[model samples]
Target: MNLRKATLTDYGVPPDDIPALQSHFRHLDENDKYNLLQVSIKYAPGIETQIYDSIVNCIGYRTMERFRDMPVSENDFYGYKRKTMAEYYHLAKLTGRL
Candidate 1:
């Protein structure tokens, strides 16, 4: 699902921690990056549960929208991945979080 920016900073990660976070993010391979995104978003203001469900393979997209939980709609949505590596990098550069 395409939502707002979800960089470390966008998730309310503090500025002091961002450099280290980005440095950590930089070294991760694809699988690790995917895992990192999952863990990283766990306590974000919103979108946490959705990301968690994707990781656990527990809930379906329709369930979230049907229950009026996540703000996603079927039209603008993809299957599971909430954010892409490209997206993360883009937002990081945009916000100077990279």
Candidate 2:
């Protein structure tokens, strides 16, 4: 499935999050990115494990690629907006769930 379709069906994310999600998926197509940020806000140990597993298996080397490309500082405004979604992913891991 296309990114938009996969994102919608698998994660149930709203249309607003799509652009950001697509940016992240361009770098790492891992499901955890969607599940953690798009789904629940609460954290759980099981979710942490799931995120790790998904990241390790699906993201693989692409994680670095995506992270490196991620926006930092003001010059990259669009990138910064995209980074917000990344932040959600980070929060998911940090909180050990989501």
Candidate 3:
């Protein structure tokens, strides 16, 4: 799935998130980055919610509030949310669920 930059942007990921997305990319090898991006755009905005819930393993009213970039303390994973998103994509692949 060779995704265009515009494709990801069109998926509703805010432009401000590019830096965070790049940070996640920094942690991945080229192939893994491509795979995760493919899964991500395949699922689009909905995947944002799914990944947030999965990453936090929430069992309550945790909602997807944590997906945004907030103060470091308020953010889950302490500014590593994008990396966590990537992890969720990887997990989805392992389970063949996404």
lDDT of 1 by residue, 2-72 (tens): 34434434545566765655465546556555654654364333555565454344455677677656765
Best by TM-score: 1
| lDDT (C-alpha, whole model) for all candidates | 0.49, 0.41, 0.44
Assess candidate 1 and give its lDDT: 0.49
Model 2 lDDT tens row, 1-98: 33222333243445665666555544644565565444322332223433333333454323534544422222332222223344555555466543
| Candidate 3 wrongly placed segments (more than 4 Å) | 1-5, 29-98
Please give each candidate's TM-score: 0.32, 0.25, 0.27
Compare candidates 1 and 3 on TM-score and give the better one: 1
Residue-wise C-alpha lDDT for candidate 3, range 1-98, written one tens digit per residue: 22222233444455675556545544665565456555544544434444443333432224334444322232332223444454444454466533
Q: Identify the superior model by TM-score, candidate 1 or candidate 2.
A: 1
Q: Predicted candidate 3: what Cα RMSD to the true structure? A: 13.5
Candidate 2: residue 81 Cα off by (Å): 22
For every model in order, what is the number of clashing pairs? 0, 0, 0
lDDT of 2: 0.41
